[model samples]
Structure formats: C-alpha cells, structure tokens
Target: MIQVVLLGSGNVATHLYQAFQKTSEVEVIQVFTRNQSLDFPSTIQVHSYNQLIPADVYIISVTDLAIAEVSKSIPFENQLVVHTSGTSALDVLDTKNRRGVFYPLQTFSKVKKVDFSEIPLCLETEFEEDYAIIEKMALSISKVVQSVSSDQRKALHVAAVFSCNFVNHLYQIGSEICEENNIPFSILFPLIKETAAKIETLTPIEAQTGPAIRRDEKTISKHLDFLQDKNQKEIYQLLTQSIQNVKKL
Candidate 1:
C-alpha cells in the first residue's frame, strides 16, 4: 500500500481524503491541519507540523498562497512532497524536500460529492524519480492521468477559468434574466445541457450560435436595450465583440 499524509482540510483535501479511503492501494496515515474542528478522525489528524508522521508521500492540498508557507513548515526533508494546485509552479514547495505537483483538473465543492475516477489528475515533479510515486497515488484514485509541465498546467488553468468559472458566471446572469422575465430557471436546463453536450462532438467555435455569431446587429442592439443592468449590458457587448473577433481569426 502507498502510505500517504494529506495536509489541509479544504474542499480538495477533504475530497481527496475521502477518495483515498475507498481505495485499498493507498492509505492516509495522517492528516495535518491547523483547523481544530474537522470531520476527520482525531486519531489520525494533527494540528501541528511537529506531529506529522513518516509517510511515503505528503500531499499539500492548500490554497495557492498558503502552499509555500505549508511546505516550509514540514519538519522532515527529502520526502516526496506534492501540492494540489493547477496554477502554482512545482518550485513553490520548499527545497528542503523533493517537490512535485498533483493537480486535479476539476472544481471541488464540499457539498457536492464528485466521482474521483472521472477527474483528470495532472502530475509533475521536480525530480524524475519522484514522478512515479505521485503517479501511482494518482492512479489509485483516478482513471485519467497526465504528465503536465508547469507551463502547460498554468495555461490549462487559465483556460479552465474561462471555460468553467466564466461560463458559470454567464449562467448566473442568464438565471437572473429568466427570473426577471417570469420564466423558471429550470426551463433553461435542457438548453444548458445540450450546449455542454455539443462540445463533445463539436468544437466550441463550431457549436457557436445566436445573434452574436450571426452578426445580427438588430438583435444584439435589442438585447442591450432590454438589459436594465449596466453590468449585464457591458458583458453582453463584450462577449458579442469577442465572438465576432474569434470569427475574424
């Protein structure tokens, strides 16, 4: 079994801990978190760095800003230490130990349980020899894995923000528009699902539709006029121009 020590108690850490529990190939020997109150068993949870025990791998699933501080706190050296960040470079970990990244390319939420096997695990290590250990640990919990460089991972993270975070914000705007028009937000579910499904077979550019794609100025103007929210009008105009610009490319 691959002995693992997980650090942090946030969504990523909690979900990783849960996923590791289900697999027989990996075991979480301990969890180090400053938070005194957590759902994890008290027996295996440590509040201080000094209490951290020996493990084959230590995974730091903290925020990007906190990653460096956490890595610096690890008392032991030369152990395989990995962080679960998509945007952060591998060098962010303290040089006192072997550094690596085990970034899962998915948004995590404590309330919504995710299927671990479906999430893509992006692995990177400063030392080639440490790669195999993280890869093994990743494979134990996920069916999809990729060896991603820090640069490639950084680019992927930006694309994800555009694809996921920005798209979700657009959905929120759509929901508000629907609510204002006395339309049920649930009515848009099928459209939303179909838009997502199309991208599987068609490129986003190919899947594009609407007045913006058609360059229908009249319809675009109508939308801008109908939107009372200044922010919504700005967003609509910006996206319309973006779509048209992409077409020109």
Candidate 2:
C-alpha cells in the first residue's frame, strides 16, 4: 500500500484526497492545512506543517505561488515530493534530494464534476527512480498518464492558454454580444457545440465557414456596420482576412 500525506486542502488537493481514499492500494496517512476543515471526516484530523507524519509520498497540491515556500516548511526525511502544478517544475520542491512534477492538465473546481480517468497527467522528475514513483502515483489516479519532459510540458501549457483560457474569454465576448442584442446566449449553444464537433473529424481549414472565407462583401459590410465597438470590428476584420488568404477559402 502507498501511504501519502496531502499538503494544502484546496480544490485539486480535495479531489485527490477523496479519490485516493477510495483506492484500495493508496492510503491518506495525513492531511495538512493552515486552517481547520469540516469537510473531512472527524476521524481524519487536519494538520499543521510540524504535525505532518511519515509517508511514502508528500503531494503538495497548493497554488503555484506558494509551492516553493510550502516545500521549505515540510519536514519529511527526503521522501518522494511532487507538486500538482502545470507551469511549475520539479525544481520547486526544494526540500528533497528527489523531486517530481505531477501535473493534472484538466482544470479543477470544487462543485464541478470531473472524470479522473479522462484527466491527462504530465509527469516529470530529475532522478529516474523518483520519476518511476511519481508515475505510479499518477497512474493510480489516472489512466492517461504521460511521461513528458519539462520543455514539452511547458510548450503544451502555452498551447493550452490559447485553447482553454483564451477560448473561454471569447465565449464571454460572444455572451456579451448576445446580451447587447437582447438575445439569449442559449441560441448560440448549438452553433458553439457544432464548431467543436466539426474539428474532431475535419481540419479547421475544412470546417471553416464564415463570411470572411466566402468573401461575401454584402454580409461583411452588414456585419461591420452592426459592430459598435472598434476593437470588435478590427478583430473580426483581421480574422476574416486571414481566412480569405488561405487557399481553401
């Protein structure tokens, strides 16, 4: 059995805490947090840094900013140390001679339900033996574990910002446009879903259907007049022109 001490009781930490408890092969030996929590069963007490006990692994599921400082606080005897951060590296865990990165790519929120099996874990470490331990720990929770190097993981993270974070911001803009037009955002739900569905089977260039790609000047003129904000008009114009220049346009 793999005994573990979980540091930080945030969203990711909470998910790992509950899920790991459910697995027969893993046991949560202790939970460490600065504040008291009623969510955990009373039998399983919360702990401070000094109260942390011996375990096979110490998983720090804290925020990116607090990781290095928290690493310094932990008094483990150079046991396996891993952090659940995407951008942060193995070097953040300064305490141990052995360190690794256990980054779950999927976003975590307390009320949101997530399937652990579908979550892709990016694992990395300086020491090869420590890498194996973190890899097993990741596989215990997820089937989609990838042993990615630090550089590749960083590149994937940059791409994720454009896909996930930037796309979410665009969704917010679309919702705002609907609000200004006195139309419910739900009307665009089907279109939004269809756009995502198309990309699975077809290349983005093939699935590209827009006034810009069609070079329908009449529709483009109408859209430009309808756009009240200069910023929105410019973005729409730029994207449309890019589509028009493509050979497939």
Candidate 3:
C-alpha cells in the first residue's frame, strides 16, 4: 500500500481525500487544513503545517495561489510532492525537486460526492520515478490517466472553462429570464437535461435547433424584442450570431 499525506481541506481535497481512503491500495497518513471545519477519519491524523508529519508522498490539494508557498513550507526534501490543479503547471511545485502534478479534470464541491471512476486524471512530472508512481496512483482512482504535457493541459483547461463554466453562466441567465416572465424556472429543467443528454450521441452542431440555426430573421427579431434586460438581450444576440457562425462552418 502507498503511504500518502494530503494537504488542504477545500473542495478538491475533501473529495480526493475521501476517495483515496476508500481504496486499500493507498493509506492517507495525514490531512492538513488551515480551518478545522472538516473531520477526518479516526485512522488519519489532521494538522496544520506546523503540526504536519512527514510521509512517503505529500499530496497538495490547496488552491492554485497557495500550492507553491504551501509546498515550500513543508519540510520534506526527498519525499515526492504532487499538487492537484487543472490550470497550474507542474513547475508550481518546483519548491521541491521531487515534484509533479496529479490534476483531476472535474469540478469539485465540498457538499457533493464526486465519482472518481469517471473523473479524468491529468498527470505530469519532472522526474521519471515520480511520474511512474503518480501514474499508478492516478490509475488506482480513475480509469482515464493521461500523461499530458503542460501545453496540452493548458489547452484542456481553457476548453473546460468555456464548455462547463461558461455554459453554467448561460443557465443562470436563463433562470433569470424565466423569473422575470413569471414562469417557474423548473419548467426549463427537462429541456436543460435533454440538451446535455443528446450531446452523447449527437454533435452539438447536429443537435443545434433555434431561429439562429435556420437564420430566420423574423424569429431572431422576435427573441430580441422579448428579452427585457440589456445583458440578456446582448447575450441572446451574441449566442445567436455564434450559432449562425457554427452552421456556416
């Protein structure tokens, strides 16, 4: 079994710490947290950096801004250290010679239980031995483990932000529009789900349906008139133009 130390207690840390503990292949020896909001299993020891104990490997799960400094604070030189971040490069852990990245490409929330089986693991390393060890650990938690270079990982992060984060913002706007028209927002739930479900079998362009796709100026004008908020109206016009561009491609 691999003996590991976990750093941070935020969304990514909470989810990964719990998931790694479930498997017999890894033993999480220590969990570090700045705030004591969470409770670790009795088998594990929790600490702040001053109280931190050395382990075979230190898994840094803190925010992007803190990963570098936190890794520097830990007093381990020979021990391998890996940080979990989608956008941050492997060099962020450069405070230690034995450094790598074990980024899980999935959004994590503290209250939500993430399914590690489906989450893709993006691993990168500066050392050969460290790379092999992380590949094994990542494969233990997920079936999809790819040795993505920093450049490839950067591109994936950008794509993910546009695909997931931006789309969620669009959902927020849709909810607001529904509220303004005195329509129950829940009424859009089915359509939202169906839009996602269809993408599994159909390309987004194939699934596209709207006045914009058909380039019906009359319907597009009607939608523009229906939107009351300036922001919503701008968004609708921009998205419609984007859809039209996609169709032309």
Choose the strongest candidate by TM-score: 1
lDDT of 3 at 24: 79
Query: What is the number of backbone collisions in each predicted candidate, taken in the order shown?
Result: 0, 0, 0
lDDT of candidate 1 over 18-62, digit per residue (tens): 999999989999998887646588889998999998999999998
The order by descending TM-score is: 1, 3, 2
lDDT tens digits, residue span 1-249, model 2? 888888888898888876776677788878787777664655555676877778888888888999998888887656778888878877878855468788888777888878887789998877888787777777888889999877788888888897788777778888989999899999999999999999999988899897887889999999999999898888788877877888554
| Candidate 2: residue pairs that collide | none
**After superposition, candidate 2 runs with Cα above 4 Å error:** 42-47, 241-249
- TM-scores, each model vs. reference: 0.97, 0.87, 0.93
- Worst lDDT run of 10 residues, candidate 3, spans 37-46
Off by over 4 Å in 3: 42-45
Ranking by lDDT: 1, 3, 2
Q: What's the TM for model 3? A: 0.93
TM-score of 1: 0.97
Question: What's the lDDT for candidate 2?
Answer: 0.81
Q: lDDT of candidate 3 vs native?
A: 0.83
| RMSD (CA, Å), each prediction | 1.2, 2.4, 1.8
